[model samples]
Target chain A: MTTTSTKGQRLPQTSKRSAKAAASDKRPDEDASAGARRRQIMQEAARLFGTRGFEATTIRDIAAATGILGGSIYYHFASKEDIFVAVHGAGMEKITQAVLAAIEGVEDPWDRLEAAAVAHCNDLLGSSEVPVIVSPYYSESLKGLRETLVAQRDRYETVVADLVEALDLPPDVDRSLFRLNFLGALNWMPTWYRPSARLSPADIGRQLVQGLRPR
Target chain B: MTTTSTKGQRLPQTSKRSAKAAASDKRPDEDASAGARRRQIMQEAARLFGTRGFEATTIRDIAAATGILGGSIYYHFASKEDIFVAVHGAGMEKITQAVLAAIEGVEDPWDRLEAAAVAHCNDLLGSSEVPVIVSPYYSESLKGLRETLVAQRDRYETVVADLVEALDLPPDVDRSLFRLNFLGALNWMPTWYRPSARLSPADIGRQLVQGLRPR
Candidate 1:
């Protein structure tokens, strides 16, 4: 009975374990292959969704992209929407984690927000395998999935919202609008951002924050 | 020869004529029906493209949505891509004209930009038949169509670019980033904007511009 309780506690504590350590503890070779296969599906699905969009991409296409059998994909994800949600959630998690880490020791509200933006822009525009997948516009076909996607993204938004709330701004300024507009600028960078552009992602973030800093 | 010269000169002046006047000047019934059919096709296609996306939305789908035969669509557009280009170009034209009209008498650089943003946000968030179709991100599938889309949008970007150039920004500021980021915020509104929200589109626009105004 004591061992069962200890095991239950240990299961929830997996978050503290390094991903590799946790995987290795599972089933060694089998775990490694499954993990690698799952990652390949995710990466390929993200790429396909990024280029072809959610509706246009199919399980078959994802399987083909990852060089796996179509039937094998169902073993990983229940449906195409499930894979999309996973991709979106993963991207959001990466961004949220980066922003949280970036602002960990920062004290000043503006500075904290700036650090978050820098981390965000870098993760989003940088060569991360799972880049933040905020679309330029919301698609009508994704209407049903929007709620799920929005909920997933809300965690990151809340982090930024907290940072914005801490700012000493003019009383008339709407903090919500300020937060949205600030993030909008950062998220929209992928539309016009070029690798060869004069400004780096960090530069873009700083410039954007600088533009919004109240006199 | 003199008559031919006068007719050629008059033909180029059609820009000054009202669209209704120009339509009536053509074969009245045939031109009117043809013009209505084209407008219907454009409106329906824009909605389909907005909802279903460009690749998924076929000429047959557009024809069905417009209540015309699939074969009849070729009378208005050469292909699905041609229709996409037309919708994009039309949206750009509407936005460009609105911004131009909005800034006609405004002289202050900031004020002109504010007016442009107001017009832009209003049209983008408003019930305009052909809203600006800037995607949330550049899709990989759009690689082939990107140049055409960018060419269509450049006319409007140049208008905003010129406005940003005129601003009395600090010497360290990159005006191009300022312009892109400014438009980025305005363009991103559709993602989070709610009609039921407290702020109207114009109010949102004013707030965005106010947020960016250099202290």
Candidate 2:
């Protein structure tokens, strides 16, 4: 009888230990799922914000789009501004990374600059499904988020400026004008570019780079 | 006594005629003042809309900026939207006219295109006093205004497209891509352009057009 009682206690202890282990193993999965949910909310929010303006969109709108209750959003993000900051920050980081990576192996400054322009254009117009949120539009409504986004943009521009300066062009070439024109062309694509338009984003980028090259 | 009575009636008639002459003489001055006032209001409104956004700026804000009572704005313009539409419409017309005029005398398609680009860049970036109000950032909010503005833009692009199609380039050269890249480079200038920056808008336009020309 004593041996059986001891066996039963050990079985419960083993079962509890296994249960705890299982719960611990599920944590990363939960975290990943939670992160995905947050991302999903941000995506929906960006579309709405981009179309309807940020101040006009409510957390409930995002919640409804995600098919979650309004209160549930708070579990993932502290506020709407928090989600905006994350979306824009992630977008800038992704674009900067793509641009930086595109020019990594190129030796010629012009080639590097061209690669960076193409990569940035592709990321902005091609891969990223989100709308390009202009910082000035949201500055009043989301001040903190705007500041952070602007800083990120400045850093990205610095990278381009550095590349422009490094290029071995003719003595008469105006480096500042080159950088402005190059960036200006890329920034304007989002305004008039239609995905159904004849020129693909890559094609446009290539043509633009050709235009940017030394005469 | 009969002559005195006749003179009294004649005197009243003479005074009435004088009053009519005075009013007629003041008409051109009144028209000039009204025109000046309209321009002033539009200028103040553009400044406010550019800095604080269209929706956030109330009629009262415009009135305060112009040193007039809020209700006085209604006397000149029907509503805030009316003012915005007018300002945007006028700005677009001016820019379109400037560009079209620049391309008129130039015979070469490439030269015409370059002239148009230079004119647009100079108008947008050179004249610090002139503001580019029809940015895509505010396009969504101004739907009716945008439709008309876009139609005008389509006409402008059609002109450019026709020129591009007529260009004597190799078969492999994508004319549509070339135009897109050229306009994209020009239109995107305002986003990153700083007045205090080293390069003038015309200088940038020249480089862009030079880079775009076929080798």
Candidate 3:
């Protein structure tokens, strides 16, 4: 019933396996500029990964996209998996912050849920990174990255869990199932949504609430 | 906002590029047994494609899995993409039949929608093939298969469109968006649903109704 309400298997709670090169391991001079540069690298890498998929995409491809040399790209991260991990983290952070901001100060649980759904759909539609984190379709092929991604997902789902907990529903309703179904719909948006389409993300979000809300 | 509600780009409506070997072109001798063999091949291929991606899965892998030699696979399927299209067709047929059967006697829009939703979730959770057609996450890389797949998707979405069309809702409610959100949630079950979990497909389906139904 938790965010980990998965079919028997799930992502790791905490993977100590370092996907990144430590400051002590590779760079002793890591600082604010380094952090910002890492963010920039992650943004482009996430986009390419989303577009090209995991296997077809290469570190060299990411480097070219970022206008940096392939070898230099590794200086920011240990490997392709490392960059993916960072992208995963960045995508989760972006969507999470957006959802959190949307739901803030909304007293009604349904309203908050709708707002969260809207923010989520809008973010996924607007940002490639959010969809990357949401689907992780490519990650299935990358076994080493699975645990790290799952751990990050658990963090993201906790935010959703809190929102679901706020809903005032019948005592008999299964809250876990509610959240699962709710999120499945929310996450599946990237596959079908279009800006040219009639429904905006917010409109779609509200309709979800209307469709699900008891008549 | 119909089933073709895609993100700017989508598959072709009618691909004159036939995936199947035409009667005059190659398989003129195809009989009932050949038809059964094609079905068997598609079932096994769909499962393999679902587990390993289309790119990673080879024709030989499918042939071995089906207990046939690699060369024999082509007797029924022209290529891997051909097998994929057939699987897509079969998966669609199975779910469509199940959903059509479930909603046959149902009349009320709310009840019919719930029936369709339950049938869909059950179909998805019960059959590995259903999820194959539903997500086809690997299709992103197969540029040639994209249009064909999208066309198949349009067919599937039509069923959903019919169900949404029957719904009695407010004028302000965007029916297309409602169904899109509803379907998004329904289609996402396979990623997390476990038989060992508490909710049965029908139970989960009912919960979707309860969550979405107006209070």
Candidate 4:
């Protein structure tokens, strides 16, 4: 059987749509000003895309939301698809890094898994837009987005699988199935999780890990 | 805090789009036959809607898939939204009944809850199309779908909550969070589930309950 790997293991191929947009664009200088402007656009774009959907939110809408003229958006990004790719790519990169860092140096594999779960949940809950943008709806509209997201998602699951494999659990325990169930639980939080809800994301994460940990 | 109620607790006021479609018709006998035909259309519509999308699938597409003329679909259902409402409404009703039935004879709360989860997962797995239709995408599209689904969903959760409450676990266990984590694990199975996967749905269901049972 093929081993199920982690999110970091699988990097998605560049979408033709995104690739076309990238090829059409001229890169800005690596100066601080250019970097700041790009960051601003990505932040605003993520919010709008999460709320209104990738297809419904236009270049003009992103520009208007960011206090930049429609043409100005093109100076930083080639197209709306390009912006979407950037937002998703950057979000995954940050989340993967945080998760990897959070679990570092933890001795117990299961404890490291729990820490990763908490860190990932905190990251999702902390950012209002990431969950929405990463939701299946927006992912469906953008060609190649699902593959990219699923690949990154698989990387995260791999982290859990690796931890499970490292554990001295019962020989009968199917680590792959355990990882699938655990990840499924973690990923569905964004659907019902409201910031206004009584439970903090960290608390929820803790409970989840506690509930799923092998006896 | 307001209780997040069951999925089918309250249906929203029909949209003007659906209301107009309902109002424009006049034949009395057509109403009875229309209801039957509407059911037929919805059955077929759900399959198509589940595969594609409610918006992406046209009346003609549904008709073609159902082996009926495009105009014939109009004779039964009012519009696309009407078909959507019927498909979602009817599917939830069936699932609710199935789940309730599964738990009825079992006196043990934990067993009942396990049965309910198994029933739900099996129902979704058995009706390949219904799972997709009842997924987050379709839930997000309709104004009342999520509320309706959650209302029905709460009924299932209530069973689990009652079971969790009766358990001999420590007092510090949060029943609500327990239910949330349990339901989260079960409900999100469709996102990654492949029927051809090594574990059968029933196997996965039992393993999930085993992993999640309070220690």
Q: Kindly indicate the candidate among 1 and 3 with the higher lDDT.
A: 1
* lDDT at position B130, candidate 1: 67
Model 1: per-residue lDDT, tens digit, B1-215? 11111222223243223335647875788657766777788889988877666666677788889997776766666666767777788899999999999999999999998999899989999888766677765456567888888898889999999999998888988888999899889888888888899999899988888888876
CAPRI category for model 4: acceptable
Every prediction's TM-score for the first chain?
0.86, 0.79, 0.78, 0.75
Highest lDDT: which candidate?
1
**RMSD (Å) of each candidate, 1 decimal:** 9.6, 14.4, 9.6, 10.0
Docking quality tier of candidate 1?
acceptable
Query: In model 3, which regions exceed 4 Å deviation?
Result: A1-37, A128-131, A136-140, B1-33, B128-131, B136-138
lDDT of 3 by residue, A146-209 (tens): 7778787787799999888877778988878888878887787777777888778788777777
TM-score of the second chain, cand. 3? 0.79
Pick by TM-score: 3 or 4, better one = 3
Residue-by-residue lDDT tens digits, candidate 2, B1-215: 11111222223222222222434555767545555666677888987776566766777888888887666665566667877866766676677778888888789977877788888888877763436574555535666566766675676678778867866666766776677666766766766678897767777777777665665
lDDT of 4 by residue, B125-181 (tens): 765443325444333346555566567556655656776787555566677777766
Candidate 4 vs. truth: CA RMSD? 10.0
DockQ, per-model, please?
0.45, 0.24, 0.39, 0.31
| Highest-scoring model, DockQ | 1
**Candidate 4 i-RMS (Å)?**
3.6
All candidates: TM-score: 0.88, 0.72, 0.79, 0.74
Task: Show where candidate 2 strays beyond 4 Å.
Answer: A1-26, A54-81, A101-115, A127-147, A162-168, B1-32, B55-57, B69-71, B100-115, B127-130, B155-171
Off by over 4 Å in 1: A1-25, A136-138, B1-26
